[model samples]
Target: MTKRIRKAVFPVAGLGTRFLPATKSIPKEMLTIVDRPVLQHVVEEAREAGIEHFIFVTGRNKAVIEDHFDIAYELEETLQKRGKLKEYQALTEQLPPAGATSFTRQQAPLGLGHAVWCARELVGDEPFAVLLPDMVTMPAPAQRDRCLAQCIEAYATHGGNIIAVEETPWEEAHQYGIVSVGKDFGRSFEITGMVEKPPKGTAPSNLMISGRYILGPEIFRILEKGEKGAGGEIQLTDGMKTLSKHQPFHGVRFDGKTFDCGSKLGFLAANVAFALTNPEIAAPFKAELQKIFGTL
Candidate 1:
């Protein structure tokens, strides 16, 4: 029987050098896409995927993120006093039940693997998920599947290491860890190997790993060793590659629109994309966008 995945780890320690000044004080994950923060989007996605606990591996200047998830009595009360019932409930209701949220600091700028390993104790022995907040997935209103949701369901059926994947042009494959599949199972396939940022035209396959992963508890063991790799930082891809050798790992090519909010261009695009679909702003936003475009 396949094990159920109930916990999710979020590694949010990046400095966000790409966004610079704005991220200097604010955690990049706190950046707003439309109205909700990027970090919240990933949290909501994980919650929708049946994640019972949310563990965040944070870094310096990330205290705001923790507070964001925590309850604010004063703010809620103020909203209630103003007769903004929905606004009051929005803050009070969305917070994870007290014990469901956890935060651990990654004191140093370690690689992704180290950050994930930071949450090992909290994750314990259950099959857990690792979601990068930088990767924003947009699913249609009627769509029940989020990027991580697909990975979780795939794990329930396949019962091995599962990672969400998507096809990218060979030229762009070098930007991500490319996967090699021995057998193609359409939406999902058995992963033979993974190469981080292969040279252009040399990637084994065009399917690049998306930011969501469903890994077994054993991955914690590998990460515990904290082996330095690829730029001397512990790379999660390295540990995963080692795990792939000993375990049955598969890559699921999920359906969804993903935005890498780590980059300025991608971040702007995500805002526009999300805003275009937002009910309160969509009508006017679309008209303003068209008017601006016509002028240019």
Candidate 2:
């Protein structure tokens, strides 16, 4: 039997150079989507998917991300005293139970593969999930599966590595790590190969690897080689490609929309998309948007 996937590693060490000077002091993961931080949204997804241990690979100036998960006794007390019971409950509801969360430093911005390697000791020897907090996935109204949960479900059947993939326009496929599959399996397919940012029009397929993955401990061994690819950094795609040679790799087309919060346009779109989903604000926000669009 495959070992249960109880732990998840979150890579949150990026400098967020794209969103400066706001990120000059604040970690990009802390940027708000709707009313909650991007990192919080991903964590909640993992929690809903039954993840028990939340491991964050962090860097300098990322203490805020860690603190966000920790309990705030003073703030909670103040809320209680002010008769803000509902707000207080919501605040406490977000806190991970003690000892469930762990933080490890990346020390340098080597790349995503290195960040995952940093969490090796914490992850031990088992299949675990990796979530890039920069990517926030929201399920469509009729869809019930969260992106990570969908990958986990695929992992159970395939028993190897599961990558959350989505289709990108063929014209823009070169901007991401694209996967080539061998066998069509409906929602998922057997991943035969992965090319990171292949030359324009040279990609094998348009299914880009989104920011979520469920990988086995064997991946750590390949990442340990420290091979650099694409951007002269330790690329996780490179490691996954090497692992695919020995393990069964599959890509699951998740049932949701993914917002690349690392980009300016994607971030703004995510704010509008998520805001439109809020019951309390959706109606008024839609009206406001309609008004703004009418003027244009």
Candidate 3:
């Protein structure tokens, strides 16, 4: 029987250098999309996917990220006293059941593989999920397929390792970790090979690894070798490649859109996209956007 995937590791230690002065003090994960923090949105996605344990690999000056998931007692009490029941419920609603969240420090800006390795002790020995908080996937309006949820569903059938993949323009494939696909399985396909930022036009396929993954526990052993690739930092792609030799590697083409929130343009775009979905603001926000565009 396949082991259940109950835990998820989120790597949130990056210094957000791309966002500049705003990120100088704020951790990038805490940056807001519309009203909720980026990390919060990612957590909500994980929760929707039935991830029971949330493990965050954090770094220096990321206390606020931890606090965001914690109980804000004083704030909750104030809201209640002010007859703001809805506001109070909103504060408590997002909290994970106590003891479900764990935080570990990455301690260095080495790379993604290292950050994930930092969470191994917490993850123990089991198949687990990894979500790159930088990528926020929006579900289709009708299907409403959350990215990680789709990966988890595929994992249930294929049961080895699954990486969420999405097609990118062939011209821009070199900017991401591209995968060479094999045998088609309809909703999913075999991942024959992976390359981190293949040379322009030399990419094996236009399918790029979107930021969601369901990895077997054996991956920790491969990552433990600390082999560096691409950027000289330990690369998870290298580890996944090695693991693929021993385990089945497959890709699930996520049925949705993904926003890379680490970049300023992606961040700004995410705010607009999420704001347009916000029930309280979507109508006015659309009108406001039209009003602004009308002048131009």
Clashes of each: 0, 0, 0
The residue ranges of model 2 lying beyond 4 angstroms of the native Cα positions read none
Model 2, global lDDT: 0.94
Residue pairs whose backbone atoms clash in candidate 3 = none
What tens digits encode model 2's per-residue C-alpha lDDT throughout 1-296? 77789999999999999999999999999999988899999999999899999999999999999889988889999999999998998888888888999999999999999999999999999999999999999987898878999998888888899999999999999999999988999999999999999999899999999999999899999998988988899999999999888899999998889999999998999999999999989999999999999999
Which candidate do you rate higher for TM-score, 1 or 3?
3
What stretches of model 1 exceed 4 Å from their correct place? 140-142
RMSD of each: 1.2, 0.7, 0.9
Model 2: residue 295 alpha-carbon error in angstroms: 1.1
- The digit string of per-residue lDDT tens for model 1 on 112-140 reads 99999999999998889999999999875
In model 2, the worst 10-residue window by lDDT is 137-146
Write out the backbone clash pairs for model 2. Answer: none
Best-first order by TM-score: 2, 3, 1
How displaced is residue 284 in candidate 1, in Å? 0.8
Worst 10 residues of 3 by lDDT: 136-145
- Estimate candidate 1's alpha-carbon lDDT, on a 0 to 1 scale: 0.90
